[model samples]
Target chain A: SAVISQKPSRDICQRGTSLTIQCQVDSQVTMMFWYRQQPGQSLTLIATANQGSEATYESGFVIDKFPISRPNLTFSTLTVSNMSPEDSSIYLCSVEQTGGNNEQFFGPGTRLTVL
Target chain B: LAKTTQPISMDSYEGQEVNITCSHNNIATNDYITWYQQFPSQGPRFIIQGYKTKVTNEVASLFIPADRKSSTLSLPRVSLSDTAVYYCLVGGPPGAGSYQLTFGKGTKLSVIP
Candidate 1:
C-alpha cells in the first residue's frame, strides 16, 4: 500500500485560470495515474504518468488542457489549464504497486470549483 | 477495459452483511476483479481483488463465478462507517495491451444505524 497526498485539498478558481495539483507518494511507484470525479459521476482516468517520459492521456483529454509531469518515481503533478465551470471536479492521483497485486492506491484528491 | 455494471444504490442496516454484485460480460481471461470504497470528498480506497473463485481479506470477500462474468463483494457486519460508494473494477494483466483500468458507476451502499 502507498501513502498518497495531494496539495490544496480544496480550491476555488475563476474561469480561464489554471490550477496545478501535486501528488506525492511514500514509495517509488512505476505506474501513476490521474483521475477526475465530477458530481454524481464515477471516476474517469485522465492520464498515465510515465517517469521521465510524456504522460499517456486517455481519449477526450488533451495534454494541452491537462498537462502532467512525473519527474521522479515518487512524485507527479497535474495542471488544469484554461479551466471552466465544466472542469470543476475532484482530481485524484493513484499509484499501482509494482508487484503481483496490481491494486491501485489513491490520494485524498484535490477538489476544484471553477466559478 | 471491460465495462462493468452494478447497482446504483442499496440500503442496509448496521451489523448486517452487505453484498454488492457487479457484472462484466466481456471479462478477459487475464482480467481481475477489484473493489473500492469511496467516502464523500475523499478518494476511492482499495478493498479487494481476485481473479477467480473466492478471495477473503480482513475487510471484505470477493466471490467470482466460474464463468468470470460476474462478481460479488461481501462485507461482514457492516457498520455505519461502511456507508459509502463501492466500485467494481476489471483490468487485464499488467503490461498487456488490453490492460486499461476504467471505473464504472459504483454501488452506493447506505448503512443505517
Candidate 2:
C-alpha cells in the first residue's frame, strides 16, 4: 500500500464552477482510479487513469464532465466541470496494489459542496 | 460484477462480535468477495477478501462458502470506532482486464458503547 494524498481536501463551489482535485501517491502504481461518492450513497467509479493514455470512464460518467489526467504513475487529477448542486459529493482516488489481496488503497478524499 | 444484497443497517454493543452477510448468487468463478469499511467524510478502507473458505488478517475475517454465492465479514470485539459503513464488493480486473469495480449500498454498523 502507498500513502495517497489529495490537495484541497475540501471546497465549496457555486453552480457552473469547476474544481480540480489532485491525488498524489507516495509510490508508483499501475492502476489509479477516481471514484465519486454521493451523499448517503455508495461509491461509483468515475474513471480509470493509467499513465501515458487517455482515461477510461465508466457508464453515466463522461470525460467532458469529469476530466481526468494521469501525467505519471504516481499522480493524477480529476476535475469536476460545470458543477451543480447535484454534483456535491466526495471524490477519492485509489491505487491498486501488486501483492497480497491486491487491495486498493484510497486517499482521504476531497469533499465537494456545490451550492 | 455480481450484484450484492446486504442488510441496510445493524446495531451492536461494544466488545461484541459483528457479522455482516452479503448475498451474491450470481458471482462469477473469477470474482472475489471483498469487504471495505468507510468512515464518515473519508474514503473506504479495504478490510478483507476471499475466494473460498475463510481468511483472517489482523483486522477482520472473510468467510466464503463452497457455492461462492455469499460471504460474511466478521469483526471481533468491535468497538465504537468500528461503527461505519461496510461494503461487500464482487469482482476485479481478471488478468490484465479492466480496472473497474461496482459498489452496492453497504450495511451501516453502529457499535454502541
Off by over 4 Å in 1: B94-100
lDDT of 2 by residue, A16-114 (tens): 999999999999888899999988999998998988999999989999999999999899999999999999999999998654355788999999999
Candidate 1 vs. truth: CA RMSD?
Answer: 1.5
TM-scores of the models, in the given order?
0.96, 0.95
**Per-residue alpha-carbon lDDT of model 1 for A8-109, expressed as tens digits?**
899999999999999999999888999999998999999999898999999999999999999999999999999999999999999887764667889999
Per-residue CA lDDT of model 2 for B1-113, tens digit only, reads 68999999999999999999999999887788889999998888888888899999999999898998999999999999999999998886334454337889999999999
Question: Top model by TM-score, which number?
Answer: 1
Q: Please tell me which predicted candidate would have the highest DockQ against the true structure.
A: 1
* lDDT (10s digit) by residue, model 1, range B1-113: 68899999999999999999999999988888889999998888889988999999999999999999999999999999999999998985754433446999999999999
The window of 10 residues in a row where model 2 chain A has the poorest summed lDDT is A96-105
Candidate 2 colliding pairs, count: 0
- What is candidate 2's CAPRI-style docking category based on DockQ? medium
